[model samples]
Target chain A: AQSVAQPEDQVNVAEGNPLTVKCTYSVSGNPYLFWYVQYPNRGLQFLLKYITGDNLVKGSYGFEAEFNKSQTSFHLKKPSALVSDSALYFCAVRDRTNQAGTALIFGKGTTLSVSS
Target chain B: GAGVSQSPSNKVTEKGKDVELRCDPISGHTALYWYRQRLGQGLEFLIYFQGNSAPDKSGLPSDRFSAERTGESVSTLTIQRTQQEDSAVYLCASSLLLAGGRDTQYFGPGTRLTVL
Candidate 1:
């Protein structure tokens, strides 16, 4: 089985400050991790992914995530937050050993609020 | 090129009625996915289609939830005997069927379904 857990339901950050949304996962084998952002009343947008190689992956809108194999974590981070950056963030994963036909499992989601 | 697109951006129906939602994946995308997201939650995987065949439909909530795709292009999800609990944003995503499912999925705008 494969599962992703976003430990925070809501994260508050001031504009220009750093922000982090935590995510952890459990899988039978190595994991393929992904981050997606959803604005109000909009579909999810792909942010970044950790397939192999680099532990740090940069994504859209100045967002990035670090994949730590030892910790089983992939946490989304931003160096400077903006009010427009507020949205719902989701972490998803699929076991690398699983069949390619299988769908990715998603976390419960974290709501990020960047106040001006 | 156009990203994934879903039809009937919004649909409102009475319980017990049948509704069909459509999705058009990006051209040349070989893998398509269907997911459901309720208010304030993350995406729930419903199905995965590679080309025209669905190898995993295990995420379909019930027998009433069914979907089919045509040779890596269009897909339709038909919900029979709709219930209020089925109301949510139905999202479609498409990606290249790369090895180990390492491709980043592009998403559609999503169809918001409301069952009264």
Candidate 2:
């Protein structure tokens, strides 16, 4: 089975400051990692994904994530934060060896609070 | 590009009643998925469908929960004899294809089911 862990329940950062939301994963083989953000009462929106290649992956809304295979982490990052960046962020993983119809394993999610 | 859509954005039902939630995937998407999100929690996979192949129902929590998708289009998830524990937001997502990480899953607004 595959799984994702988001150790922090909530994250706080000041506007214009760099922010990071940590994520870790466990899978049988190579992992397909992804990040998503959710606004109040809305479904999760795709941010980015890490399939292979470069360890650093860029995503929507000026978001980026770094895939550290050795550390089993894929932490989401932003060079500058905005108050509007506050939302719930999720980390997900899919085991590459799993069948075509396998579903993503998600973490509990981290609530981001970017204060002005 | 309409993106994914779901019907009955909110639902309130009494215990022992059966409820059905609907989802319309983005056009041309061949992979669809169902997930449940309880309050203050992350997504929990329910089922997955790729094209017309048999669905992967491993994530289904119980036999009372069932889902069906027709020809890469709309889908309906039916929950029989709803329980208080069944109260949660039912989310639907679709992807163009399911080949490793290239297939990005787009999500819908989700149906908030409140079992009374």
Top of the candidates by DockQ: 1
> Chain A TM-score per candidate?
0.98, 0.98
Candidate 1: where is the Cα deviation over 4 Å? none
Off by over 4 Å in 2: none
Q: What is the per-residue lDDT of model 1 for residues B12-53, given as tens digits with 9 covering 90 to 100?
A: 999999999999999998999999999888889899889756
Worst 10 residues of 1 chain B by lDDT: B50-59
**Whole-model alpha-carbon lDDT for candidate 2:** 0.93
User: Once model 2 is optimally superposed onto the true structure by TM-score, how far is the C-alpha of residue B93 displaced, in angstroms?
Assistant: 0.4
- Candidate that would win on lDDT: 2
lDDT of 2 by residue, A57-80 (tens): 999999999999999999999999
Clashes of each: 0, 0
lDDT string for model 1 (A29-112, tens) is: 999999999998888899999988989999999999999989999999999999999999999999999877478889999999
